[model samples]
Target: MAIGLSREQAPPQAVEHEPVRRRRRPVLVAVIVIAVVLVALFVGWIGIRAVLARQQLEAAQPSASAVVAAMRSGDVAGAKSAAESLSAHAAQAASLTGDPIWRLGEGIPLVGPNLAAVRVVASATDSVAREVVTPLVGVSATIDPRSLKPTDGRIDLARLAAAQPVVAKAQTAFHAAAAGVAGVSTASLIEPVGTAVDRLDSLFAQSSPVIDALGNSTKLLPGMLGQNGPRNILVVAQNPAELRATGGLIGSVALIHADHGALTLQAQEAGTSIGPWPTAVSDIPDATVGIYGPLVGRYLQDANYTPDFPMAATTIAAMWERAHGGTVDSVLTTDPVVLSALLKATGPVALSSGDTITSANAVPLLLSDVYARYPASSQQDAFFSSAAAAIFTKLAAGHLDSGKLLTAFSAAGTSERLRIWSAHADEQKVLATTTLAGALPVSTPQAAGIGVYLNDATGSKMDYYLGASVSAGAEVCRFDFRPTSLVRVTLTNRAPANAGTALPKYVTGGGTYGVPPGEILTRVVVYGPAGGLLAGTQLGSDPVRIVSGTDRARPVAVVPVQLKPGESKTVTVQFLNARQVGPGLNVATTPLPPNAGSTPDVGARTTVARIAHVCDSRVK
Candidate 1:
């Protein structure tokens, strides 16, 4: 067997064969180990891919479901939150699927599956955005959702549906991607879930109907018309006449409507007459006229005319004469239209001067004619006719007859007594005739010649008739008379043989005579200390002399004067017993100057006194 063993020959030892067997055994063991390792690796990869696929599928399904549910429930915020979570997971999953590790199998195992899941998440987000966001945007743009009508809601729904195509496409892609990912093994599933969640969040961000509604409602119209508001109107008128007419029209108009709201009429005559005309006409019948008195009076006072009588005559006589020739009677008789025209032109008539005409001595004759001609029934008619009769009677009398004059005087006297008695009853308590006896000092200068005189500061000349028993020779040392707010007196001295002998200066006694300081004296007249006139003055020099010894004569040259300083003298003033006068003076009062004292006594008579003066030389 050992003959010439060539290089390719066979071995002959069993030991060598054993070595080869041993080597074979080791090689086989190594192969088995490799096979096991490969098996394990395959199983692990498959398991990972399966798990990822399941996870991606699970994540996609739920996120999509959640968005759908949120949308259905109208919970845009919840839907968005869920969608964002899902999208984040989807993104993570997509990233993992695209990793080099996932590509080791050419992305066959996990990439497609994971991408599919991501697509699903994205699609869900898109769906949510379309379903909720678009409508929300529309509502925000158009109207506040809270205020939107049901119709608006329907409109918004339609808009949302119109936007659904994009979302549907996105959903389709997501489903396709998710199916792809499920078909293959993917490395990650979180990415698609994350994408869906993010999209959903975005959609929800746009769903702000409530907020939009609130914002829209904050505008002007709703707030003003709604609960809180002010109710007011500003009305104006043109002229006083128009205002009055408008007012009357309005008042009359109200009687027409039964259910009209509260109505008020006012007149503003300051500007023009046309301003209120339109409003008056519109308001109608319920308005009042704000015209002047003369106009109003023309329409109201009665009109009766006779040759000897005129009834309720106003400046009507003057107005009539001015308009036509002759007296009111002739015109009225000649043309009735003239009276009608006068009445129409003037509006309403009032009697302002009847008292004066009634006092004339011819009143009886005038009244007789009116009483005979016009038979009046009503009070107004009677008043008119009686007044007319009085006028006619006076005219017929030719002049003021004694009977008529006496009657007029009696009426006038009665009226005056009533007025004076009412006014002075209270003041009469303190004033007395004896109070006028004094050598009061005057603070202002007086006129010359009359040493001292009682003056009517009202600019009215008063007659002071002297009484009996006052002697011409007697010196008036002191004088007393009734006190009034109108009279003031001053003292002076007669000129001596020397041309420049200064007049006597008067001074007031600092006694409580009840008269206010600076008050002008009125009514009371004073002479010398005794009941006698001042002597040494001839009748020519002193035309106004106090009569004595039972003769009645008004003291002449006794005029009122303002007092001058240091012109103090004593004189006796007496109140003459004479026939009572007729209607007391109706002199108008003048306001005291600003610098006048605030003392009660000072201002008391100022209200009724016709005369007032401010001794402040500082004023021009």
Candidate 2:
């Protein structure tokens, strides 16, 4: 036993313990190898799921785009297919993102909230794809928009009444899905994931409202289109040549009566046919009266002198009532641009003057060259009346493409080129929520919208040659600073250099009213951010007199700028909107004629060069 206890030769029990130690090494190595393999497997699994999620998400984008295009084009079948594909992709992404590895990773401290947010967003995408867009697409497919158009020249109110439930259901689904998505927070999300969250938020915000509006419109359209007794609406064709706040002086007017699915175009007359109102004009601001004077209260055609459509509509209704001895249900105003849009579907309309107007030349013919072609206002009025009647006849006969025409009409309203006002409380309720209502947007200390209202000081059709645009840039958007904007409006007169002699006398206003031969006198009214101040104003380096006032509680500046043949002038105004509010600076301008001889120029923009990091820098 003593000999066995030596260093080389230990006792039997000690030798047995050494062998046990050796066995422990092998066991430890085995456990370490297993742990390494397990760790490697888990990491690789996470990598695989992440890559799958990314691929699914990336693939979902174009499918979403296809759905949007289909929605716009009224291609319901395409929308459904694309939405289904998107739903599949979203489901796959959600599955990959929700796998065990990612679930465990979601509990890690720094990345936990982000991963959870990713899950929430993925779930929202799946819901929106499956629940929100698909149902709407189904409704769109069921409702033949062409059926909504009057086939016998009358709106089928029964058809509209029947489709109401479909639209309503779609609306409800959209809002529910949108609300669920809105409940999710993406504030802590990271990188591309955060971007997706933002996009989905925007899509819901946008898509839901549109469907909501559609539902609301459909709810009221049937009754308004004459489900109840017959409805009479005064249709006014405004002339962009004699630019007024809304468009131009009423070039023509027609009494249109609708019953069931039938449309009757009654007596048609030119602006000259409308007499002065029997009652005194109401709601005329002192500023408008200051410039337009007694003329503002006299003529029904001049009702649009004020930029407010509701006020003008009331005055127009009053005038129509006074002249015809009864009030109308509504007043519908459209310009050459809208006419051009209509022509695209109705085909070429031949005028009694032996001239044919297609969509390509309607704007130019109505606004510009008509003066050159015809000297007398009576002749011009006759041409307009003929064009209108032709379109009415074609639409009444259902000879044109109804879907294309309806879409064009919709596009016009969305562009704010088509404005309608209803005297009926129910119809007004429907219109209030749409741009078609043409109500000036309300601006607050936090959010402000811009208005560019123009009036013809020339008493001529010179506005046809006028090109106008506006650009807005923030003076400072720094932290803790009150955000201000500097807006620049440029007016260009593209009248021929020899406008006085080379152009026809009628085209240049025929030197009537003793005005300058080629000068375009424009009364430029700039409406700044609703609650913002008019910091200052300048016209081409010269200080112009700025007359400040409020239109329906919104601030406005009336500054007049004149341009001669081939002349361009720029006007600059500074304003302060909500300190850190949205939409930056919303600019609303009068829509230009879409079918001019050359490009009809009118646009709005936001610039960064004038964006000041500090609060005090100028936008120059």
| Among all candidates shown, the one with the greatest lDDT | 2
TM-score of each: 0.19, 0.81
lDDT value for model 2: 0.73
Q: What is the C-alpha lDDT profile of model 1 across 1-620, one tens digit per residue? A: 56787667857654557778978998999999999997678556644754674475457557756755775455667766766665555544444444444444444554444444444434443333344333433333233222222231111233333333433344344344334323432235455444544444443334332222222223211222111222111111111000111110000100000011111221111111112221211111111122011222232111110001112122223333333334221111101111122222222233333433221222221212222343332332345334333333332233323223222222322211101100122222211111111111111111111112222221110101111111111111222321111122323322122211221111111112432222222221322221212222222233233322211122222322232222323223322212212112221111111111111111121232223321211111
Indicate which candidate wins on TM-score: 2
lDDT of 2 by residue, 1-620 (tens): 34435656754552457888988999999999999999788778776877787788788889999988987687778888998899899889888878777788778886776776677777777666676666666666445566666666766678567767867776776677667667767777677767877777788887764676578767777766677778888988888777888878788888888777578898788878878765455656665566445566668767787777887887787777777776588888887777777777888877667888877777777777778778787887887888888878887777777767866767777677678889898788778777777667556555567777788777787787888776666644545456676667788887778787777676667668566778788888877666566777889987788677766545677888888888999887777664336535566666653323752312112121323322444422
Candidate 1, residue 569: CA error in Å?
A: 99
**What alpha-carbon RMSD in Å does predicted model 2 have with respect to the real structure?**
6.6
Q: Going through the candidates in order, what is the number of backbone clashes in each?
A: 144, 3
On the 0 to 100 scale, the lDDT of residue 94 in model 1 is: 49
